[model samples]
Target chain A: MAKRSTVIAITVAAAVVIVGAVGAGVAVLGSRDTGGAAGAKGDTTVTVRVWDEQVASAYEQSFQAFEDKNPDIDVKLTVVPWADYWTKLRTDVAGKSAADIFWVNNSYFADYADNGDLLDIDKTLGSDAKSAWAPSVVKQFTRNGSLWGVPQLSDAGIAVYYNKALLKDAGIDPASLENLTWSPDASADTFVPVLQKLTKDAAGHTADDADFDPASVTQYGYNAGNDLQAIYINYIGSNGGTYQDGDRFTFANPKTVEAFQYLVDLMNTYHVAPSAADTNQNGDFSRDQFIQGKMALFQSGLYNLKNVADGADFDWGVASIPAGPEGRVSVTNGIVAAGNAATEHPEATKKVLEWMGSAEGNEFVGASGAAVPAVTDAQPVYRSYWENQGVDTSKFFDVLKNGTIPAPQGANFGAAFGAYGPILEDVFAGRVPVAEGLQKAQDAANAALDG
Target chain B: MKWTRTLLVYLVLLTGAALTLAPFVLSVMTAFKTPEQFARRSSLSWPDPVTLENFGVLLTGRTEFGRAIVITVLAALLLVAGQLLFSIMAAYAFARMRFPGRDALFWVYLSTLMIPAIVLVIPLYLMMAQLGLRNTFWGLVLPFAFASPYATFLLREYFRGIPQDLVDAARLDGANALDVLVEVVVPLSRPIIATVTLITVVSQWNSFLWPRVITTGNDWRPITVATASLQSQYNGNWTLVMAATTLAVVPLLALFLVFQKQIVRSIAITGFK
Candidate 1:
């Protein structure tokens, strides 16, 4: 009898304590919010967001210069790692709480601009301001007759990185690698023979030897896999096949089929490249293998220049990407700094954006050797920085003279990749025939984009 | 036959233990290697000349991982204290009292566990932004300081299984409700309480998504977010990342060491083992 009353009393007291603590927590949180806003009282604070920590550090020095000239405005940089950058940006923009300026890639620009989330660059910075940046990035960002972002950085072009000692051991001259060209016709091909000479079996036999055992391969000659940017897309373009045409997949073209067949045969037939079973799941497998001195040739871009320079303990040199039947055509991708359309501090934000696009401001990125600036005039600093390290930067830049294809540019490109990624993985692993796989992948990619 | 069966069981258990411990062993091994050594050698290989450089870079360099550890500790401590206190009181009420709509209210609160956390991210982010709490310590910890549905449910079920005679005897011995709770209920519920505390601390420590969305700068960022920043877009720096990971995991491991006995007893009593 006494227990029931005791239980009631305890329940009442507990309820009061629970409610009181929650109320206090909310009160403290609310008060702190007010304090934070009030603390930024003197100068209008404009925030900038980026994904790369290296670029963020470089921009810290650049923005310090910006803040020195404009004493009344303060700039703060926020870095989100690449894994969460898109997710957080989408949520923040939808909530109307994104930074005044944030970096956007080509694949995501169309979505943000279509949703009216980005400030129209042509309208904000005038159409004449486009001349200050690289024409390729400007063209990539321009849609429906208005520019969407200020160009921040560009991937110059793809190039070949060779392990000099490995090439020498294989009796292959590094200089010959520059002029190596491939063709679908085996009689006309000069590239595979070079790779075959570099590859070896466990019994110290090169792949070209009659006694060479494919199962016991100890060294690979090249990195050929399902890598879209580094391996297959460049091959597709160089072979006169198209991967995309006006926001749709065109990978089922006959030339694209021939290119895939050549790549698959390099892995499954000739065994000059690592098996696709290894490289399909791990995108960094080829780069790591090259750095480990197990592979002779690695085709990648400026993104990997510092990776190889810092990671490799052996001597290495950069050379032009092997040309195909048509020519050496590489994919050129770039990143842009887009402004918030509804930013509260429009004047301050525009000032920050304008400074980011200028040659003096962009030079900080190039001078640090973190990336090549999109501003053409600032590119010399990047070249000179690499030259000081004894690396020839022209290998990356020289390919730009022949021709280039833009990186995937539709808003649905990510969705399209998701739909076709597994099929491509199967195709690369040689479980699916090349022609049939490309057709299935093309249909799936187009369905995803058109849906 | 008995000896052979026991030997077989021991072999299986040893194999399982090795498989479980392999990745953690590799992470620690990798953390002690230089970047070049990490890329050159097999992942399972031991560091030849073990270096402190990765730790030095993580703790003293621009990553400022030491500061992140301090912030994570403070947030986890606050969250554990608040969550345990409120959850205990709430669970006790739901178990003992026969109030109006008590079961209905309890059921309604527990139903929230069915809703996914991803659905709440946008709304919660908007609320915090409107309050000007973005990038602030309060923004990172405040939303999670209250009683969670899962914790409350676990505690309530355990409280219900406690003998009612214990409470009645305390009442007859001239003890008030508060005395009965502090001296009787809590003293006997040590194992479950320890379990709750450990669970709260570990979840709050390893929390990534909410903290990633809430804080932006290093000033208020926690260890999980800072550890993620060790890898840039282009560079993996696996050795450096593994170092940061090893540092972030030490406190949780220490906590487990301290409370292993009570946690095991809780698992046994709850029939979860």
Candidate 2:
């Protein structure tokens, strides 16, 4: 009976609480039927969606200028995390509840465009926009003779971010770091000697010393983790390995296999890098380790420039990715904004999309040092922004001008990677031999690509 | 020997408690430290000078967490109350009232618990969108504001355990079914009701996926969604995230404290874990 009565009291309290809250919510949120379409025109609220908060702040500034000039359309920017962005986007696009204009990279834009869920930018902006944008970015979005997305920003691909102080302690010149090169043959070379000089064992012996113990090394010479964008893509590309031949995956290239072996050997044999067992779990672990001054040559892209700048206690500077056997290679990638096909206001959305494609808009993203804007004229702002931050970003553009390979291009690349990403991790961790692991990975990827 | 056994039990219990509480304690401590301090010191080290900069950022309208908290509270209260009220009424009918095919209907409803919540996400999203409720406050709360089959099943089992003679006395006194339910059944079923209320509250409060999918902007975003946004927006800065989480969880902790006696009574009566 006591139990029942206490339960009764709790239930009554629950009722009172709910009723009180509902009443308060009605008063605060406005008692109304919000059943009509969302983002409908009172004065035209054009919802613009992005994944980066820092980048979204830039968009907000850009949109402010846009609104000030237009005075008709009110733009609201929504920033979803990178993890949830695709999942929410698929549903939103499917349900016709997506933002009027939203960010979509080349890898993802295909599915949306193929499904007719995105508005073709060519129809909105015409050919005038294409010539002004970076050719690779413009080409990335163009499918079936139609441009699906307006190029917003591009990544200045894989470059070595060496801690200058760490290099100085190792008695290596910061200017001379660019000469390091890797070979698939695993024989002692310039890169190996460099790593040996930089890598020190717990007993204060360099890797060059025969007594140096791989087990007790306190700091790593390099950060060779399983980052698809920064580490392997640059390795495979610089080694002249091709993963995709148009629409299908073909990682069976010997150069690709050799490149995988070298990466795995960096951790397992030479012990120049951190093992995959630790770093592979979190994509950001290697980056975090590098930023904490625990690692020497961190070969990542311009995306991590801000993280390194804000976090590092020591002086650091960028150098071109190490020259591989086939000269240096970098993988440049771009982000684009796609307008929703089912958006209610087509004219307003086109105007918004056009603004996003314009230099006036993308320059805000560049000037903020958030991204290397894809609008050809806006690239200078990005470079100057980084230059002000005490890092020369000219190499980022040099790589673009020199041989920057675009990331694997295809409609089925996501599916292919989904099938083989984990298997490649085993290869990196040295649980599976690189040769055998990649053979299996190639089979799995080809099967997925076929589907 | 007895003292040693007591010591062993305490040691084990304390170790288990420490394991559970360590993460939470670390989060709170981290929340009070600056970025420079956090980066320099070990995670276990105490903050030399505690600062609420993270809390200041989260609560000072930079994240719209205050709005999210109010929305979450409203959603939870409404969901819990609705679930309890409807569950009680349904359980009464299932337990005492002789309705045709009641068992079959109740079994069918109970069987729905087998399906995963994810299977319902896309369909539920489409259904809500068709009703034009997506991004609205109603959409955030509507999916949860009903009797759960699990709650109803639990209540029905508890309701059946009540003595028929007591119900008969009220019925013989010219009390209608509604009067007997309101006056007799509910009063004696407080423990089960309290248990159900707690379950409903916790489940609704922690609901992340559905609310995340439904709401676009912060207008109808709940605490869980808001907390997740902090992780990505702030680049996994644990201090700021911990502050947001600490703010989000305090209300639930307060709710738990307020109903301490009722929860204890319910546990004793129902033997619920």
Best by lDDT: 1
Could you give me the TM-score of model 1 versus the true structure?
A: 0.90
- Pairs with steric clashes in candidate 1: none
RMSD of 2: 3.6
| Pairs of colliding residues, candidate 2 | A4-B190, A7-B190
TM-score of each: 0.90, 0.92
Off by over 4 Å in 2: A1-20, A23-42, A186-188, B36-41, B60-62
Please give, for residues A164-226, the per-residue lDDT of candidate 2 as tens digits: 888999999988877777887556347877887788778988877899899888778888868
State the weakest 10-residue window (summed lDDT) of model 2 chain A. A31-40
Q: Rate the local accuracy (lDDT) of all candidates.
A: 0.86, 0.80
lDDT of 1 at B18: 98
For candidate 1, lDDT tens digit of each residue in B142-227?
A: 89988988788888888888899999998898877667666678677777888788888889999999998898756678898998
